[model samples]
Target: MSEMLEVKEQETLSETVPVFGYELIREVLLPDILGEETPKILYWAGKNLARKYPLKSASEIITFFKQAGWGDLRVVKESKNEQILELSSEMIVNRMKTNGKTTFQLEAGFLAQQYEGQKQVITEAFEHPKKRSAKVQFTIKWDMKDFA
Candidate 1:
């Protein structure tokens, strides 16, 4: 199982897919089907995905984001109970330009779940999309006294 997971992660690292298909589903089809609840549903879906593909550390989470074509993620700041991460990519820029209502809730939820798994604490994440900068900032926070 571990080997298969490793292979799956590595396989997509260098693979490329046409963005049109991805956009067609994510931007068009999903919104059409999910309607106003799309962001909320996608956020929960991301958390479920994290559960299925748990990573042991922050580095692994970063790699997973890249492999999954989310973006280039970097830790901007870290403190005792919170961490700030920034995500950017050409795809992100394009999405922001094309869709004014773009949301990064999915990535935010993924980060929240990943950190919860790693820290064994109750964690939550908030997404701040900077349309002007074409980047998304994720603020992941955990209650030190709360355990998962």
Candidate 2:
């Protein structure tokens, strides 16, 4: 009985929302409500969300991105003060094809805050969407001199 319950819990945790529903809210409704400021607002919103769901390691952040249906996140490069992460998915490809101006500011901000929490330093992230490649690259940089 306990084994079955555990399986059920795992299944529930892994359940995902349909892509159409997600796109409707994220692309349509949000833009309609927030207008030109949508991208900026989403970036800050992602930071707040990171604060609410803090994770200890890069692996945990990667897992969280998958669980949240954002995309498959992987570290492309890492240095002392900077890290490059790439996110790719079929959904991301679709979004890029459908909307040329699609922004990944939310994901960028999430990464920035997560790294800030991990390194205890002030961090910022920039999103570069590769429309041709159908991927988004995030460059996260931390100021070692500025402690958070």
Candidate that scores best on TM-score: 1
Per-residue C-alpha lDDT of model 1 across residues 1-148, encoded as one tens digit per residue: 2355589967776877899889888888999999999999989988998898888888988888887889999999999999999999999999999998888888988999999999999999999999899999999999989999
Considering every candidate listed, which one attains the maximal lDDT?
1
TM values, all candidates: 0.94, 0.91
Model 2, 77-131: lDDT tens digits are: 9998999999999999999988776888889889999999999999999999988
Error (Å) of candidate 2 at residue 58 is: 0.3
Q: How far is candidate 2 from the true structure (C-alpha RMSD, Å)?
A: 4.3
How does candidate 1 fare on TM-score? Answer: 0.94
lDDT of each: 0.90, 0.88
Candidate 2 clash pair list: none
RMSD of 1: 1.7
Which 10 consecutive residues of model 2 have the lowest summed lDDT? Answer: 1-10
How much is 130 displaced in model 1, in angstroms? 0.6
Model 2 stretches with alpha carbons more than 4 Å out: 1-11
Candidate 2 local distance difference test against the native? 0.88
